[model samples]
Target: MAGWEQTRRRHRLVHDVAGDFARNGPRALAAWRPAIETEFGGLDDLLRDVQRRLHTAAEARLDALIEAPPADLDTSVAAVLDEVAEIYPDLRRLLDAHASHPAVAEGTVRFHRSVRTATGVDLTRTRSDRSRYEEKGPVRDRKPVFFARLRPVCGWLH
Candidate 1:
């Protein structure tokens, strides 16, 4: 935190994590998602995108280093991998917790839609039909939602 500024910040730290990292180069994430649905049709695609983003961010941070390689980079990636390996257990807990609730997911869709319709902060760039990073996949009940899309940028720091 000394030399480097606190360049990035996210409120939904745990949930929008992949979205957070891909802000640095969201084109990478945009290329990966085959589709995006309201209730999240394919968790695998999201998970894969998250993993790829993690790898890309970590590698980019390390590669852009002007100093000698930090002694802990390897160990750090290892530790991160170890924690990511625990993804299933964590996911199981989350799914178990949300299994009984459906509105909670639907509400997420409303939130995005509201952002598109109401926000003063223009997100139009991200939702463009021509965007290379268009969100794709099936939504709840495997029905494709409207063409609503997002490129998932890195916020300001990202």
Candidate 2:
């Protein structure tokens, strides 16, 4: 790809990764809390350390991008952006490294609250799988209620 495309792709990737973490990280932690605690019952200190490091690393990545001056796409800018993308995988891995523990999940209640506030959607709404699907006959509609609800949260017509 061209240099500009590479830079744009990196920025997009960062945006995607951060959003994912912000949105799902809490639930992931909450979902597996029991297992996390079970496996590391005596490691609260370690888990806290890991969580702190992970948060710091994520912040550092954002800080780097935020501190960067706006520049028109160019070869140098592309290189820097690519370098930033290079750390994406590592950041993801770190953020999720302690996801196997129950304590982390328990700890994520606060995180989930913050994310919900920022996104303006309750986690229950997004995480729910309680909707049932019904088959529609010919010339009939299916899941009108479910689809209608989805429009408000997902903001689109089905």
Estimate, for each residue in 19-88, the C-alpha lDDT of model 1 and write its tens digit: 4333434343344343332223454434433333433332333332223434554333333222322322
Q: Candidate 1, residue 24: CA error in Å? A: 28
Tens-place lDDT digits, model 2, residues 55-141: 344333333434553443232222232232233333334334555577566645554464345433344444211111111112123
Question: Which regions of candidate 2 deviate over 4 angstroms?
Answer: 1-42, 56-91, 94-97, 121-158
**Model 2 poorest 10 in a row by lDDT:** 128-137
Measured by lDDT, the strongest candidate is 2
Q: What are the models' TM-scores?
A: 0.26, 0.28
Candidate lDDT scores, in order, read 0.33, 0.38
